[model samples]
Target: MELKELLDIERQGWDALCASTGASFYGELMTDDAVMILANGMVLDRAGVVESLRDAPPWRAYEIDDPRLVDVGSDSKVLVYTGIAYRDGAEPAFRGIMSSTYVLTKAGWRLACYQQTQISQ
Candidate 1:
């Protein structure tokens, strides 16, 4: 898949976070066995992800920089980028290296895994 297409999907996820709709958004996007490996050292399964995001605070703003799409195989791809996320009343943004792996399925392109690495700066 083209970078733009996968990039759009990534942005849609960020937009979902900004709008505080990540619960439903991810619920639909993630595959049954998907997992989000957060920078905070939490590994969440699909159900955990949905529950965690259900009442999570929204991001005030976000930026995705230097994204690169990696071709893993015919039915799977990984999108990696540096992400900056802002929170209300927070002095500094949360910066991390974010990567999302998507797999094409009968349903559509669905998230297989998502990971975040904290950036020390």
Candidate 2:
């Protein structure tokens, strides 16, 4: 896929990731080698990422804002954004800024890495 097409797919993936009430679709979008650095400094691999979502209560709601895309090359790109995640009955909503890198693979564009830092209001 072209860089522009990959970016569009990534945007769709981001929305799916944020809005996923289940882990399957989200996990499918990530590369097998993908890793995520959580706001709490925990590092999660592909399985771990899926497990985390599987173990959490469904997200009541979520929103992503200011998604800025940076082209790293013809086949690579990075997206950065801030967002809020709300879970049923959770207090203080989870607010954070995230950066995710995507790379074109034979299977299409897959998330290579993701890192998120908590934001305090």
TM-score of each: 0.95, 0.79
lDDT of 2 by residue, 5-89 (tens): 6447655654555566446755887888899899898999989988888656555666777878788987778887786777778
lDDT of 1 at 80: 95
Candidate models: Cα lDDT each: 0.92, 0.75
TM-score of 2: 0.79
Residue 112, candidate 2: C-alpha displacement in angstroms: 0.7
| Model 1 CA deviation exceeding 4 Å by range | none
For candidate 1, write residues 34-91 as lDDT tens digits.
9999988999999999999999999999899999989999999999999999999984
Clashing pairs in 2: none
| Cα RMSD, model 2 | 3.0
Instruction: Say which candidate scores most in TM-score.
Output: 1
